[model samples]
Target: MASCKFLFIYPDINEFSHAYDGNNGCYYYGIAQLSSVLKRVGVETGLLHYTLRPAKEKFLNDIDNFTPDIIGFSSTTMMIADVYEWVRWIRESGRHSPLVLGGSHATLDYKRVAADGLFDVIFIGESEESIVEYCQHYRERPTNILGTVVKGDNDYIFNPARVLEQNLDRYPFPDWTLFDYESLYDMKTHKRGILMAARGCPYRCSFCSNDRYADLYRNKGKILRIKTVDYVIREAKAMKIQYPAINYFQFVEDTVGFDRIWLKEFSERWPREVGMDFYANLNVNVCNDDTIKLLALAGCRRLQIGVETGNESRRKEILKKPVLNKTIEAVVKECHKHDIDVNSLNMIGLPFESEENILETIHFNARLKPKLLQCTIFYPFPHTSLYDYCVEHKLISESNLSRTDYFRESILENPKISQEALYFFRDNFKTLIKIYRYVNIDWLIRLVGYKRAGKIIRLFRTRSELKKWLYQPRKKLLKYV
Candidate 1:
């Protein structure tokens, strides 16, 4: 039989607000690794990344040119609606190739995906080995594959569960050959290389998908796993050789410091061997003075830490991240001391969360004075604990659930806090932080606290002229020297 060819489709639709020239900072390592595995076995692979929705003809023409035996789609919860539309279009065009759906969405909601009958196979959890096995036996139409849910004559074939890959170094580095690295690197401001040194997060944050995904493979094996420090350094060196333009790397793990031993070894060797700065996410609950120092020694330029909410009780009870405010402050202080830039991630518009609570979050970030303050309207992703809570409270609007771009807007029908109020907070959150940071509001914050300070900022937020004057770019006048 001829070698099977696969086409990987990724819908990176960010609602088209940002530019999408096929390289807008969205890299799917799963698909890249899958392509590598296929190539190692002499199978052919192609990728059609759609940053924007394409015309039907364009989509069809690209597929026709490749003529892949299998078409696979990797999507997050945000891209599911668009994926459904594209799959339907493919079916309407009389294509007979087997369709596969994988990624976070499929792994978390395999039952729903299988019930839809849109895909011939739905891969759950890790698909690196499963995919190669599927391609090898696609002609046989076997249904007993460990990690797949395959379509049957009458119903779906639920295969036995597959275990997680504890040893990450078992597989080769991701196939960057599948992507246009030069174009991607050119579009990026930092010319950063993206790499994932680990597999999972240890904490089970309610709003995050990690907890839900972990429960899916409860008895399989250890959920959180990391590659050896030597393996990671080797990958980094190879990445530098492949793309000499890459000045630094961004390790895109949910949390990178869970294993301090692994981190210590990496920190010691990374700068000495690679000689480039890097950035990675750190859980505030896991970070300490020593961790920050180790990271700085490794040439870590910035660290992204989550400060999801300011209401301590809500953070613990609602979000399941039982970290103290003082703990967060100390972590930020250590990061600052080490000259590691901190980007604090926050969320607003949580269920049953009051305006004052949101203000507390803003005020809290201002106090920490992180180099970057990032906020997003809370989006209760499907299958997450928060999603179930929102559903139980009848706050979810099924009609408006189509869009998952929480950064743009909220879809909750929250009674305590209106969507309009949520929008107001999201729109002005950064500006409020700026006011607290630059302007003299320490007295007001100390005296009136979060609620009253929020009122004053709300008034300021309404005045566009004042905002424009405060933040407008100043022109550099030419002077003869």
Candidate 2:
């Protein structure tokens, strides 16, 4: 069999793949984008996909059958422990595949990944362009490839991130038609596909682990490389041309409405240009009556806003939410007035959050009553404002490639609250949402797909009972940072 120039393999991490209420455990749009680019440039490529729940025999069969020149795997901060296990497998496999690691996890931890010598190369951010150059010349002088780390001299080579492709118009449309996108779902997007228009968020949210995602570019500051309106229309037009049938077109931007003028242009032009409904995130503070009107005209069916908390003091002094509670209410009201569906992106754990702070959250949502709401237990993302605070306050235990969950276990660093109480409260945060409104059937169906049907059902057994239990605090020995 002729060896292919490259192979993209999404390593299998058991338990996480089947989880739908949380991490779907799948690769991002990079796979589709990179695959399309490689194929367009005439590089022979294959995807060795082994989903978390794949039959063991099939997983082994796929790996053994598709032998290629290089293997590239993607990972995240929480999943790096599982990812390291897979990297170890490749190293101990007795085969020299010249493994490479890409995506957020590898980008932030370049020093760690490179120093460990587990991966042959670590492709820095937006690796598509650099990867092509590496493949073309690997057979000649492999050591001279730019944007790659070769293990020997303890050199900290920081390859400049490929400038955001100016001629993005030239890149091949993402090959979503090649993979199964319907199986991937989260609270905001139900059984969907994604379109990445922009990357690197400027907001310094304390809990977010975004540094890894935007690592190569942060040195440049909150600078973003956005696809032009023409490019977005061009991409959307190509989506139908290529995939023919796609579930949904999501902006995948940290804040889609970041640039009001860009969205205004998209809202005015795209309905006629591409003719597709897109779901996107809206920074609550940035939105207003005009913003809602523009977005409604743009065919935005779903809008997700990060309403971290309702505590006004916490919003300003602690969380740094630019707008006040009234600002959020006005925005939510305007969204409702425009007949746009709203989803509250709520957080459970925070640096200065308290039981009273949580009630403010519950009361805030009870009043707003969004069509949908997403509840997340705070996962302290590395390289965020929160991560720094945690380190400074002796909140975070020393972390490394092996720490998957942000909190090593349930935890509270301050003397005010107990770790056990925080965990129990966090565990029942979902029920609080259910107390106000029924879970969407589509969301419930997807959750059931996780194979944890009993757990999902028992979670909402009696909101009152759960609330009473949460009210009574319990302390335990738990490490969380």
Candidate 3:
């Protein structure tokens, strides 16, 4: 019998996930999840990073010691150049290990990355099946693999895409033992382990890369899939037993409450079983009063939803979220009614985004009075509607891979909206949100919540009574596209 070592690299880039970059200090414990997944398939995995200024020689030594047959990496779009450095280093080692690149960047631009020959394969979609299959087969047949692009004999045959829209429960519970949890958590503001219950999102907001996962599973389009309730609960319980002291359960489900049955069942069973606070992106289309009721009961502490814009035109035209303005009104009101702690995601700098659009988003968000409001500058990522639009319209001067993050504004020329205008939009609206949260919103809080439940108490007799709040003539968000 022969054995192979696989090194899954979460390259020690300066930035973390979408939320942990720049000003906000956050910890990433995803290595634990990734490692657990690998272990499920009978593979030994280790992480390689030079985070603490570890010498280049020390890094080289570790790579030599591992002597891996395959090296897999996960990265954000902006971190591709950073990946290049690591790839260069690995290549320099002269071992020529088969490199496997996954994560958002590679998922979005697998062909370009594979064509460069930096990696032996690019795992296109959700990696559980494809990756595990590839690793096991690599022990026998390394080249001709499924669900990825490999360095085939005479041509680069990118395998027809497939989305691994499978039962999440089938995979092994993430091995939390693999992470430097305390070391990583000690340096951050928010600390807790995260688990994924489902894969893919059905919605197609223009600014979002939601389909990235489905793109990997199959070349054809499809909606999201969830891990079964029993499977999800089993993992949740197993993780609780494993972590013991973990108080927060963070789920990376693109939209957590998409199904009312799962939400209600999880909510009902969570407290008695896992008893942890959780945070996830909840889709407005799926959530209603009953869903919020279940979530609150289930020990969910935070619900993050996007109110990308308030402008009717922007919401439908630019944002491409089927959410009607009225639906947004109902969703926010319902969340507040249930007293669910809420965070609203807002973005500025869509190519044609104007000050009027910004104002509309702000005015609309003000109605919900979310516990936290984040305003992010948009970065055009590969394979999204927004990215195509920007490229086609020649919205920016040049597209530099370096500017895929918040570090720089649009590098493209002829940007429909100026960088100055984007920041101005953020500044004008964000300040109001800051001030509202910091000082004068106590009265508003009472209106949205109820007592004895530690949740949102309804201010009106029924949702219909809140009609005034949703459709007030004076308060209507009249901001523009």
Best by TM-score: 1
- The worst-scoring run of ten residues by lDDT in candidate 3 lies at 449-458
TM-score of each: 0.90, 0.79, 0.81
Better of 1 and 3 by lDDT: 1
**In model 1, how large is the Cα lDDT of residue 225?**
90
Error of 3 at 142 (Å): 3.3
Per-residue alpha-carbon lDDT of model 1 for 147-232, expressed as tens digits? 99999889999996788889899888889878776665232555878889998888898999897877877898998899998888
Indicate whether candidate 2 or candidate 3 has the larger lDDT: 3
Candidate 2 colliding pairs = 206-386, 209-381
Off by over 4 Å in 3: 12-34, 49-58, 139-141, 163-165, 186-188, 212-222, 397-399, 412-416, 427-429, 434-481
Candidate 2, run of 10 with poorest lDDT: 472-481
Quality of model 2 by C-alpha lDDT: 0.64
- With candidate 3 superimposed using the best TM-score fit, by how many Å does residue 284's alpha carbon deviate from the native? 0.4
